[model samples]
Target: MNNPTKEEIGRILKSSKRIAVVGLSDQPHRTSYMVSKAMQDAGYEVIPVNPTIDEALGVKAVASLKDIKEPVDIVNVFRRSEFLPEVAEEFLEIDAPVFWAQQGIYHEEAKRLIEENDKVAIMDLCIKVAHAMTKTH
Candidate 1:
């Protein structure tokens, strides 16, 4: 997989304002929750995209990416690697510019699909870490 440069990651973080977090957990202790909370605290709009949850991080959750009415800058995924292809398919249907899979989650096919569409695909990376490193927030 091609990794984004620190500058590229910083550019994305600086340009993006709204993020749709797929598989975001409602529990505060969960990594998804913690990460999303951090992003929210950094002034990014974190939209929870999980069918199983009603809401997360004080924001009303949507069942899927397609359910989001507002434009999404990044589709931040927290699902396992095995589920990436499926999520990638759904991502293609949306207008988001970036597809991001959190740390420990990487799939070549998903990356191919997203990049094939001329969209940014970032895998096996933590958005928060990238954000902190770039100090984009």
Candidate 2:
């Protein structure tokens, strides 16, 4: 995956405040849950978007991006590669500033769609690592 510089990532994080974590799991050991918890503890308001669970992190778990009422600053994706296209489609339906595809996630077509229509920022990186890297500088 193409990783952005510490400075660039930090700037993006600083500019973004509200994040919708797609495919966020309820299990404590899951990547989604851990990342969500880290993000929440770091001051970002994370809205968990999980279909199976009704709540996560003591907050209501929205079934989909469409279920989120307010505008989000970023949509953080943790789903598999096969689901990216559909997720991107859903993302286009919403009004967000950026689309973040975590560590192992990436989709060129989805990236193109987001940039072409909404022109939102895309970061295919680990939010946790980004936070750690950002804090060091």
Global lDDT for candidate 1?
A: 0.95
- Spell out the clash pairs found in candidate 1: none
The CA lDDT at 5 in model 2 is 63
lDDT of 2 by residue, 47-69 (tens): 99988898888889999999999
User: What's the lDDT of the predicted structure labeled candidate 2?
Assistant: 0.83
Model 2: weakest 10-residue lDDT segment is 1-10
The top-ranked prediction according to TM-score is 1
lDDT of each: 0.95, 0.83
What is the lDDT, from 0 to 100, of the residue 35 in candidate 1? 96
Candidate 2 residue spans exceeding 4 A from truth: 1-5, 121-123
What is the total number of backbone clashes in candidate 2? 0
Q: Estimate each model's TM-score.
A: 0.98, 0.90
Weakest 10 consecutive residues of candidate 1 by summed lDDT: 1-10
For model 1, residues 40-132, the per-residue Cα lDDT tens digits are 999999999999999999999999899999999999999999999999999999899899999999999989989999999999999998999
